[model samples]
Target: MSAAWSAGCVRARSMLSRRVGAGGARELASRASLEEVLQQLAAGPYQRGIRPGQSLEDAQRAVAATVLWHLRVLAGWLPREGAESVRALAGWFEVANVVEQVQQPGTPPYLLGSLAVSWPRLARAASPEQMREELAASPWGDPGGSDPRTIAVGVQFAWAVRVAERVPRAQDWAAGGAALLFARERFLAEQPLAEPAVRRAAVLLGADAVGSASFADLRARLRGDARWVLSDVDGPGELWRAEVRWWDRVARDALKLLRTTGFGPDVVVGCAVLLGVDARKVRAALEISARGGRPLEAFDVLA
Candidate 1:
């Protein structure tokens, strides 16, 4: 392999290992290599193209071809029963046409609740065809199979926090899990989607950070308490609106309740119940930071 291709593979492996679990790492890495091959073919000779910068659309399409190839190749690794696994990864990738078709830009805010339901099953698809069939079976239709290449850019565009939420707890080095949790928030904020539930995932993920959200998701979460109705959030490079009426309600009058807090331990564990993030990851991270370093933390890291 050329040095450039080799380096790209290395970068792909490192990121995939972080994004997916160790179980899927090698396969994901190999798929990334194959993706580079596909991209070179589709974009013309890779060596010649690199000397001169390509147009934005060309660069975008090339990167997209890489993401689709990886998605298809990685999904191929699953067992017949691994549909759920494949589906989750696909959800992590958040194919764009699905996002665009389902959501509108100006709607109520929302959270990850409804969106999270699809992820586990989405990750389970055994092949690209299977992935396409699965999404088609849902309300989203078959965005992948109909025009796989055309939509891959949209897929990369849509991934965001939906991907970060999938990171297994064992991957985080910090005991507090703060870094990974923080990372998830940042990813969503960085690529905040128009979808409310997805937007809420980022909002619930971080407090001081920025991200966009439709009012629908925000209102859905605000079924109760409130000192405030809406707040400005930071997204990719700008500020967007989010509502926190309920959060303010709990923080102000309902503050004394031990179980009421959303940002602390019990809440984190409860979030684990809802979000499927391993509590050990969060606890381990907290402990590591608190103690500076220890054996249990290492064991948790290994977990």
Candidate 2:
């Protein structure tokens, strides 16, 4: 590895030690209340963003914000190429900003600083047409059209494509996620895939498979790693489990990458993915705690 990547990899691995692992998240889930959860997290890496009295939505956003901040710090240690890869993964934050901008104008953005893709330009957009124009001019590219719902789906697909292009190892994960996005729209939401969405899915899943009428049809049509994401998902009610399984798959794949790869972009990406898994686990735990449910029940799908 180059000296810069070597240094960045070292930093990435070191950051992994800061995560509240599965065990810690389970413990947090066992807490009696959100206050207890926050009190326990007060001394951790997430302490800055998560605080007492924040609503569940605010706390979830805080978890994401904390993860983004780590990505920003990690990017600073990387070379230009390595930093670009991290930046591509960080596009989720930009997508979130765009979604919020389309859904609710003037809500404060996630504060991405230098890691931003198009938030600076997107923030200034006063209407959907302006938003589409700005996105077309930026790296995110048009998001297909200005319709808020279509734009949301389009940006997500764009983010997946960008990540797959920059981080080749993440191609399967990106495609799997895109597959799930289509599945959710088709099954859980009971909505037909929008024309733009179908067109985007065709890029990764092929035109023949994108029009599958049922989960079984879609699963049979898929011939790549993306198919496994829906392995045992029978219907809409179990879709939540499919999502949980997706994260489980991500966590497993990331761990394997960390264990098998030397100090390189794969290791950096692996570290980032693992951190994301931990953040999601923590968020789930907080939700359970806030609802006064059994602590371990928060992860029932994993069982």
Candidate 3:
């Protein structure tokens, strides 16, 4: 890992440690409740009813907003440097405008076509042999010796479409149908992946794009926390698939935003406010992170 990435991770650890505090990593390890949170999110109305031409725009905005909000919180979240980093990463808001123009029940076709375009560019880093092996893998992980990045994204598109396919039908759903469904699957499974794996998985699943960061900073910050055990991040893994060139972009943008002048905690607060989380809980988590970089009752705050 580069020094910058390491520093960023260290900062993340420092901030996270303060929030979780005193054996808090274990709490987070077991806390993957999304149903209650989803239910709550669903109970609330969408910012506005979707108009005939607004579905895609709404999806774009919602996804972008959600990512920006979470990242913002994590950025300015105390432990000054970590807070700053989160703030810095918020710059690439343009990424969020991706699918803002498609129609309803929209996750499948719209996102599929997007993958066709995005996947190729993303897989440019993979090697020839790695690409060949990947294509021989899952429903979409295959590269066909075509463009590995494209193939990678195609798999992500498939995963998301599959996840969206599983959505529970209900009145008053807030986010897009696919996000809700995929999130539901993740929560129901309560599958806890290592932070990096989850980060990469989320990218593959098309949440936000990812870039690898240096682990040194994170290592230093994580020194005090047991739950920050990085077993999952280290692996006898796919060499090509292990890290990405752009993951750092996510972190950098977050950092830049945090360093901007005149933006108070409210930006972060307003961002979080939009998340459907109890403001008090997020605040408490931030407060804890600020104090000692511990993990908050992040898992328990939902629902």
Best by lDDT: 2
lDDT of 2: 0.83
Q: Model 3: residues >4 Å from true position, as ranges?
A: 1-35, 43-107, 111-150, 153-249, 261-303
Cα lDDT of all candidates, in order? 0.32, 0.83, 0.31
What TM-score does candidate 3 reach?
0.22
Q: In candidate 2, which residue ranges exceed 4 Å CA deviation?
A: 293-295
Instruction: Encode model 1's per-residue lDDT on 37-134: one tens digit a residue.
Output: 23333443222222223433343333333443443443343333222333443453345433333342222221223224354454455455555566
Q: What is the lDDT of residue 74 in candidate 3?
A: 52
Tell me the deviation in Å of residue 251 in model 2.
0.4
Q: Which ten residues in a row have the lowest lDDT in candidate 1?
A: 170-179
Ten residues in a row with the worst lDDT in model 2? 294-303
Instruction: Write down the worst ten-residue block by lDDT for model 3.
Output: 168-177
Which lDDT tens digits does candidate 2 get at residues 79-188? 99888888898899999999999898877788888788878878999888888889888877766778788778878988887887888888888888888888887877
Off by over 4 Å in 1: 1-54, 80-83, 92-95, 98-199, 202-303
RMSD of each: 18.1, 1.9, 17.3
- Per-candidate TM equals 0.27, 0.93, 0.22
Error of 3 at 135 (Å): 15
The order by descending lDDT is 2, 1, 3
Per-residue lDDT tens digits for candidate 3, residues 1-303, read: 334444444443333222222233233223333222222223332222222233333433443344344454454334453343233223223112121111111222222221232333323323545543543453334423334333333343344333223221110111122222223223333333334233434432333311222232222222121112221333222111222211222223334434444444323323322232222233233233333433344423321
